[model samples]
Target: MHPRSSLTVLAAAAALLTTATTATAATEPVSRAQVAAHFDLDAEQQPENITVDRDGSAYLTFSFARQIARVSPSGRTHVLATLPAPEKANTPNLGKAFVGGIARADDGTLYVTYATGTAELTGVWAVRPGGRPRRIAALPADGLPNGLALDRRTGRIYVTDSVHGVVYRVDARGGRATVWAEGEALRPSTFAGANGLKLHDGAVWVTNLDKGTILRIPVPARGTAKRIQVHATGMPSIDDFAFTGRGDTLLAARDDNEVDLVRPDGTHTAVLTAADGLQTPTSVAVHGHTVYVPSAAYLTNKDPNLLVAHLDR
Candidate 1:
């Protein structure tokens, strides 16, 4: 990760996100989403990502606060772990240590990404039940690791570097990270790229923030990436997305206060808007038929909260 630049980058990204949402305003809403829990905006409780467990509890990464927290099914919230801050915390684009995208393994181990612009602390962290959090793999000090996905079958973790425009793979047990994929399609045009990642159907799915596109890369048994294919386009400022478990249909969270249902045919419909208590949503998580969205209020700077909705099966 590089040092924080001027506000021009933020302004440009905000404009792109807002424009993309406005273009889809004509689409009819599919779900009436509601805020399940409101965070303390003054205390930097801006949630950057989320993962829901089988027992109905939700784990979240508070980006600006550099903390990981858990919210119970009944709405009780508590801090689970806090990442250490660098002595000179100046992360690329964000200007501070950021804790983003989280994935929960079947064994209840939580893997979260932390970017601090320093090799000493920037990497993937593993948080086990009743245990201290520890770094599993150290990433490049200049790379901004934004999204993470865990392959439980192979016991591996895949990370997306937004600043460096590449994907890194490392063992879940903790070791060095190696470059998994890097191509022109993952490169950023202006602000950030390769922001979200997922493992599905023998392939790796990712989203490019600056390019506003979703990509699918075939993963063979050799752990190498095949040709990258563009799955969908016209999604600007997209942060993270979750599949709805119906074919390839998915819910994509836009940082500009919108959520869209994207079909396998590349068609999309705006299902949720700002009226649904979305204050700059950062990521989406689908557990069964329930949809969870964490709004960080990164740009709007309004109510940061967790929004919930049920999908029609």
Candidate 2:
């Protein structure tokens, strides 16, 4: 993540509406989104990414706070784990220890990516239900690891390095990481690249924050990755996205205080915006007909909160 003025992003998004014209969602009479839980900005409760459990509880990585917390469906929050902060924080890109993406595995294990700019702590971490958080795989301290996803079938974890423009693969139990993929599509243009990642339909899907595009890479059973394909384009400042139950349709969280509904055709519509209490939404999660958007307030420095919405069937 880079520091981009929300005004500038709003202008760019307004212009994009001409080409990536509004879908039916924009014409809907009522906004489905509402703030479900609010956090203390003074405490640095900036939620950077989110993962929902089957019980409707959400696990969040409070980026600047270096803590992982769980928000119950009833809006109660409890700190699950607090990552050890480096003595002298100097993370690349952000200049501090920041926990970004998180994924919840079956049997109640949570995995998250941490970028601390220190060789001892920069890597993927696993948090068991009642155990402490431990680093599983160590990544390059110079690179900013942003997004993470788990392939449940193979128990393989995939991570995206925003600064180095590389994708790494590691086992569920953790070990040496191997460079899975890297190319121009994943490289940073201004600040960060390959910011968000997900596994769906036998492929790895990622979002490039600088390039403003969504890419898809096929993961074959033979362990060789095919060509990278551009699945969607013209999305600037896109952080993380979650697919709706409707096939390829997704809701993308932009750092500009807005969320867009992107269809399989590569077109999108503004479904939620600043008026809906968004303050730099970082990631999105969908469980059943409910959508979760966590705003980090990175730029706004106001209310960092989790906004819930009823997903129209």
Candidate 3:
């Protein structure tokens, strides 16, 4: 990737210095944890992505658990839906289902991704409150669908296929899937590529887990890259992210047990960590200055927990 312009670099440094001063003056980068109540999941549930409804209820996907759960703002949780098991049953050693991403439509519908390429387990699933799981779009068995983003205004859903290093577009209402974008930047050097996703600043933003970078492709993109800009580099293997409703972003670095704060210029600052009691904090959701994280714990000492951290108001 090319280096960002010197002008952009300067702006990021200025932002970084200012943030450092503010964080120092504030004592804590993020406030003490606040737990919510809408959880139907137990310590064993391996929650991957979190997408919140308009009413603030969050729908989280359990990656290897074959289930999706809705946790209300009050932290109450219930089984929202489940993905199907692979036809041959557990492939190799992993679970039959590997649900990856979750996104909520403006109308309360939730879209999720199942990456396990088995049984009929590779596709995008849509569900509403009290509704049955519906396969909205069947992806490729050769690809592992890992990230999801919705352009609700246009009724288009963007999905990332980790294994194939490509992005797919499907009708939010249900229909055929098409290759939306693909480039060398998305190809994984090791295990994962094109992992986390979100629509921001009129572009589709994605994270490469193996590459530890975030790339943004302009909206209405087609073919290959007209341009793919590196939004942030040296990310801590970020899983999924939530835009702060402002220009900043909160990135969940699952393996690092930390949430990284990214500024407008794309320089990430360290914010929350294990000292904050984080345990495999896989995804983050934001409402104003408050950030919500699901700590899957993934066999850690603590049972799976929901962690809340408040940034500057």
Candidate 4:
């Protein structure tokens, strides 16, 4: 399928992987062979975001299928939760599920985003193993919620509205939501707005895709945190990212087929690319020293694939 994605691309990418002199020595440049690809998931799955559990299982958002699936350590994938499909075709969300962002709570519960054209199904849904999805919070009609992150310690879920440039905080129990941050800078200039999010090290880290900047907000114990500050800039089309769990290093998946290693100081270098067998890596998740990335390949590549690269050895 998809003609196996051209080996010539991988060969050219290997040549430029290891040239960063100031990068971490322990983090080796990932080559094509070093990255193992798995899960020829159905094109209808349209896998978008990924979150790795402690046991190394990767739970991904299946956008088109209107569901979520889990990839085991051995790479077999099965549906975790399925939502209501669109009733009519040619609607804004394309009559498919907008199951976009995914994040996990400390208690093994999942909070997922569904920005569907259908009003009833468009909200934050909750799921547990062997359970059906229950809408926890209903996103307003004007909201186009996308990326998500959970603050386990505070038992709150943070969601990003790509259309409104607003960050919402919802209680994990009742799903009561309120706009935590609304800023002109957070709004999208192009089609894509705030696209990726993660809660780490006492702060909420977010990437504005259309605006090409990374913003950081102090973690709030309650309503909203003020003084939103821009942490990094000039990163265009960056998607979901993962903390390397190693000294503030970040693996950010750029929609253009590369996973960037970003430092706290806002400097980033490419460690993997399309040549490294990445078609359109949309999200990154780290398990131990290795990083797992999903090639969303929505329209171009027929089979959605997952790639793993050992970032720190």
Candidate 5:
């Protein structure tokens, strides 16, 4: 836990539990709006990734909590499913289950990645809205799948292995997996940790949290793919992104303690700053014009909760 984060959490807890007073706004200039609501989670809810559906529902992975949670536009939250722990401990300090990438298919089926400290337990999973989950394919031992994206037109799923710094493609039906792209640009030598991914305009957009860059890769059957830098001007902790309704704009949760709204042209504005009690803003999802940001303020004394920001634009 960082020292500043601890202080911020203590202050937030004092404000939330004891008083209704608002915290000081962030120093960075930002469009102002009241927090619509706060979705409270358990102590271990460490939300890592988020994806929004057409119906204004958000699917989020609680990596530390080992469960997938669904948040509706109405601010209602429910645990979708919890990953089962392994029958026997495999590795030292390795928990029973770990979850990373997540995506939803057109037919409303949700797919997520699960891994254990041991190589054999790492695989992709498919789960229906209210149905059972089944393993799809086992990833290589060195592959630490982190981000997920589904191509609706091609019915293909793309997975990013942060550990190996490579992207792999899996069939929608889940059989064989193949490497799609891997290189210095796609997987740079320095800070190549990939976290979030999306398919837009026939190109794959991925966020390298460590490098603080959103990379664009042209899809297959389209000749050679090149990595294009999208947004890297902001702070170095940009985590995940949620495309606005217009699709031309996106809101990136900086996890370094702020949130940024970035345009396709590279222009960005700080929509939420730390002053508003944002501690480690992690995952972001937008529905309609409203944006949802979930924070894991474990380092801070403040209680962990989801922050809602309504875009007046």
Candidate 6:
């Protein structure tokens, strides 16, 4: 979650785009209000991706401590399960056993992406409420799974690989995984890292961490595919995004201490900024009118727990 020096050029380009886009609409910035509840975790819990259930409960992934946390609407927090630890002497990044991408199916089964320090040990897992987690399937060496999205219509699970810059599709029952879409420009200079992903309106939307852009690839009925840049500018280290229930607004988490609301008409306004005390805002999800943001710093300091902002729809 540290500031990436390599993203300087991308940040500069996004800033220019933001300035140009903001000039046209020029809507008054909406004031953000802290909600009624917040979950402050212990020093060991570093929450990442979050998903809300139909019952108003939230499930989030803990990266550093390797666990899934279940949070109640009242701000109660409980550790669901700790991921299996990797073997000794594994690669540094591959050795840390943790879950990144988490999504809940309609049946209440939680599908989480488990990653060992090494690429070979990375895979997906399914965990039911109050039960032990079971491995779904192992990912390929190039499949660096980071984000998870479930397509309820076809029962397909979309997983994004940040390292290899590809998205893999697996059946709900954990069948053989195949490449759903890979960026056409594989070179580092062209497309850097593909981190978070969301499936909406027959298209897959992905956030490029290193490139600071959001890509949209249409879900074709068959054959090879290509992705187009739907919103490439106006994002600073865009990590994860969620569509507001209203369908016209998008909440995006900027790696910097801020979150923005992007309208469907291609205009955006800053909703939560550094002034609100957001530290490395990594992931965001909306339920009802309340938007929940998981701050990486909350793993250490219990002060800001989960930042809740009430949206004026």
Ranked by TM-score from best down, the candidates are 2, 1, 4, 3, 6, 5
lDDT string for model 1 (142-180, tens) is 889999999989998999999999988999999999989
* Over 4 Å off, model 1: 1-29
Q: For candidate 5, lDDT tens digit of each residue in 1-313?
A: 4677556534433332232224555323233333423444554666667776665556777766767888655556788988776565242223445677788887778888776655666777788868877778777754567788888778888887765667778887888777776765455345446667777777777777667777777785853345555555544777777777665577787876778878777777786877776767777766544466666663463555566544555
Model 2 lDDT per residue over 170-205, tens place: 998999998898999999999999889988887899
RMSD of each: 10.2, 9.4, 9.0, 8.3, 8.6, 10.6
Q: How close is candidate 5 to the true structure, as a TM-score?
A: 0.79
The number of the candidate with the highest lDDT is 2
Encode model 3's per-residue lDDT on 1-313: one tens digit a residue.
1245444433432332233212211114466454443232453476778875544456788776778887655456787777666666443224455788888876678889876656365788988867888888888876778899889788989999877888888889888899888898887878778888888878888888888888898865445336678888887567778887656454545557777877668888667776666667778877544566777766464646666556565
Give candidate 4 regions above 4 Å deviation.
1-43, 89-95
Please, what is the TM-score per model? 0.90, 0.90, 0.83, 0.85, 0.79, 0.81
Residue lDDT tens for model 4, 1-313: 1333334323322322322112222224443223333445554666789887665567898777777888765556788888776575222424445788898776778879887665677788899767888989988755677899887777788898887788888888855688888786678886767778888888878888888778888876656778678877777788888888776678788877667878889888888776656767788887654467877786456546766655543
Compute the lDDT of residue 158 as modeled in candidate 2.
95
Question: How many clashing residue pairs appear in each of the predictions shown?
Answer: 2, 0, 12, 2, 1, 5
Each model's C-alpha lDDT? 0.82, 0.85, 0.70, 0.72, 0.66, 0.68
Candidate 3, position 305, lDDT? 61
Sequence-dependent TM-score of model 1:
0.90
- Higher-ranked by TM-score: 4 or 6: 4
**What residue pairs are clashing in model 6?**
93-117, 94-116, 94-117, 94-118, 95-117
